[model samples]
Target: MTITPQNADDSCLINQTVPTGVMSPPSEYLDEKKQLPNQNQNQNQNSTSHSGEDQESQKGRSRSIEDATAPLPSSSSSDRGDDNDNNDDDDDFPEGGLAAWLVVFGSFCSMVCLYGLINSVAVFESYFSTHQLAGYSSSTIGWVFSVYLFIVFFFGVQVGPIFDRHGPRLLVAVGSLLVVASQLILGLCEEYYQILLTYAVLGGIGGALLNVPAYGVIAHFFKRRRGMAVGVAATAGSVGGIVFPLFLQAVIPKLGFAWSTRIIGFILLFLSVIANLLVRSRLPPSTHPVRILPDWTLFKDLKFTLCCVGVWFMEWGIFTPLTYIVSYAAAHGQDANAAYTLLSILNAGSFFGRFLPGFLADRFGRFNVITITNALCVVTILAFWLPAGDSRALLIVFAVTFGFASGSNLGLYPVCIGQLCDARDYGRVYSTAVMIGSFGTLTALPIAGALLEIGSDERQGWLALILFAALSYAIATSCFLGARVLAVSWRVKEVY
Candidate 1:
């Protein structure tokens, strides 16, 4: 990772994909130029003196045209916004177009269907504990959501390759069916095992199927504008987070769980229709299709290793607040409606958090912006969330501030990964890192719930959960900074 000055391409800056220094002309071309002069000299000596002057002028013109028309470095072309073949090379990405914007919109809809429900896990967790799955330990209840999250992330290992080799239409179509089916089935589950199967297992698989393609497709259409595009797509998660919870809160009492879930299923069906229509691969299939397997050799690079680990700890920490924010409010004496409202307010802040960071990350450095956001995550959790006891205002402020800071976890992580390697290798690397991070999601909620069991009282359990989340984010921040230093040293202004 310690690059020398002459090796400018070794720098991890976002768009520095090719060499910047002037290159020497090929030796063969140099020799041809050399032989042309010698041939002219020989001809003049051998009795072609009259035509020598004309030949010399023609040679000079030929060399001038050769020098002028020679290809420059790929980095220069990329920066100049030159559009090349969409199928030929990742460097040839069309930065934006009507078709590309449609893909982003489709991705937005996908996020709303998949991640939206994830954001509403708190509503389900709280409702199940008090109603259908009453008398269950928090740990048992936590598994339902954890499994959903783990599958959402873990299954990308396989989906990424399939999307790379086969394209996204089939994957999105099937995923849409499964996701809609899971919701419709969820309406009828009255028992614990039934709920687990419908909501967690089935929904998890469906999410994995669609979610990977939503992200993987974007890299096909963009490179320079990727962070902004991803940010815009990711905001749907927050929109879903806010909308699902509020809708459930308003209607769950009036219509009950069965009817509420059925309505959500119908809503998802409409969105999936859009995703199926618009999301697709603009690039052709990979020439050497990457196998559906993890590349163990990637760990050799210290920066990438840290990137993977940072995402793991990020998943471990971030979901704690998102999953338990509603429950915490209710446990601490907030009104039932106010408790659900807190989740909406939190996601409202997240709406901006996801959106603005990606736009900023594109202008500033991806690493710089992400590192700052992770730091904010740590500071907000320890400073505002951990200390907010029964004070409604403090909890509300924590919800908004922490939500804003943590929203970028999904929005910008892949962009940060793009900083580590060339665009051609991006899909594989991102999928592998996400697969590793899935372990953290699988275990985080259950572990947080177990921490609840160890506490003597509800208040102690809540504090322990808060402390765990804060510590995890602190470690994740350190890892991100470590990766940043390896990539760009201590230059805070360098955009990676």
Candidate 2:
């Protein structure tokens, strides 16, 4: 069937509501089931003679379902038969091989440009709120970043389907242009609305476009090693997170914010260009038509639906700390510059946090790893961050530990969702989750700002913020447990 953009999006929403196994039932089975009763009766009369053919057909259907549902296996008997198999070596991921590593490298570069910029948004908020956009309320400026995040996620509802139909090549190309343009324009905008339109809406759209391709391509290359592959690629965001803040610190002083932003835009241009070239899907081209709409029906699967909810709440709580950490430090007698530096420290820890835990997760189970990491984020926030409002040492520790723990949220979320459906439907599944998550992104920042407004002191704001983080963790934990129940109910010792 031709999966048009609209149909693809519709499918994404549908995938959420329906089990992938049911939606794309073995096409062969559907075809066979449609055969004439006369043919069936003839086959039944010669049942013994046709038994081998039936068994072979059944085997083929089973293999198709397995490939659709899980990581496609590495080897096939066909590999030995294809005389002109130029792709023989390319079929299976090399795991630690140079090509796989190169893909990982490319993925890292992509994340640095996309996720790094996202994590560093707080630095912009901290600086902009007190400087050029000072006339605007914190709530208004918060909307700028919030809108950026929302578009980045919301637009994915469309981008994911397109990626499924066409490979990442064209989408990445257009996204690269949009992102670079948004940055260049953002450098020139001095007005509140201009910043809102350029940075929040435009940059967000570009980021969203870049994001799906960045992580989605990993699925095409590696299956068994997917967790580690995605984790390694995910670390690029932390690299960007660390790099961009340091870039801002140096550039803002010498060139000032306007030119500094322009320089960063140029850097994004370079990275996005490289990303456009390198991040590619190894999977054969999809024959599906271009469908761009989100399929809300995918939520019908209680496990996936719960996962979407968990991600929504997780993202909502995530940016609260990212956006507010510097401001919180500044309010607590920390130097403004020093306060901004704390984000960098947190991102630095996030770098390793994204990489190492993925390796662990591959062995321990995706849901299990995510549950533990999320718990760590909540506990660390409550134990260290909540009380460390005035203690620079404690806050720094919280930042590093939380960064490490939370890093998994970004890296493993896609894989966790991927676990529930067929490989071909991954784009739809992921995009649908992000569609729901878009609402959370839209509201998280503004809500955090409102929380700050309610408190007399920033310390109280920190408490409220930490509570938000903990609540999200609790919700995420329940979702993970529910998924575990669906797959392997109440068996605590059983690996998810």
Judging by lDDT against the true structure, name the best candidate.
1
Give the whole-model CA lDDT for all candidates, comma-separated.
0.77, 0.73
State the lDDT of candidate 1 residue by residue for 9-84, as single tens digits.
1222322333445343344423223324343445434433444453332210112223322432233222212221
Q: How many steric overlaps are in each model, in order? A: 0, 27
Per-model TM-score, in order, reads 0.83, 0.82
Candidate 2, residue 4: how far the Cα is off, in Å = 28
Residue clash pairs of candidate 1: none
Report how far residue 33 has shifted in candidate 2, in Å: 25
Candidate 2 lDDT for residue 373: 89
- Model 1, 230: alpha-carbon shift in Å? 0.5
How well is each residue in 386-453 modelled by candidate 2, as lDDT tens digits?
Answer: 88868999989999999998999989888787665544556766888888889998999888777666
* Model 2: residues with Cα > 4 Å off, grouped in runs: 1-96
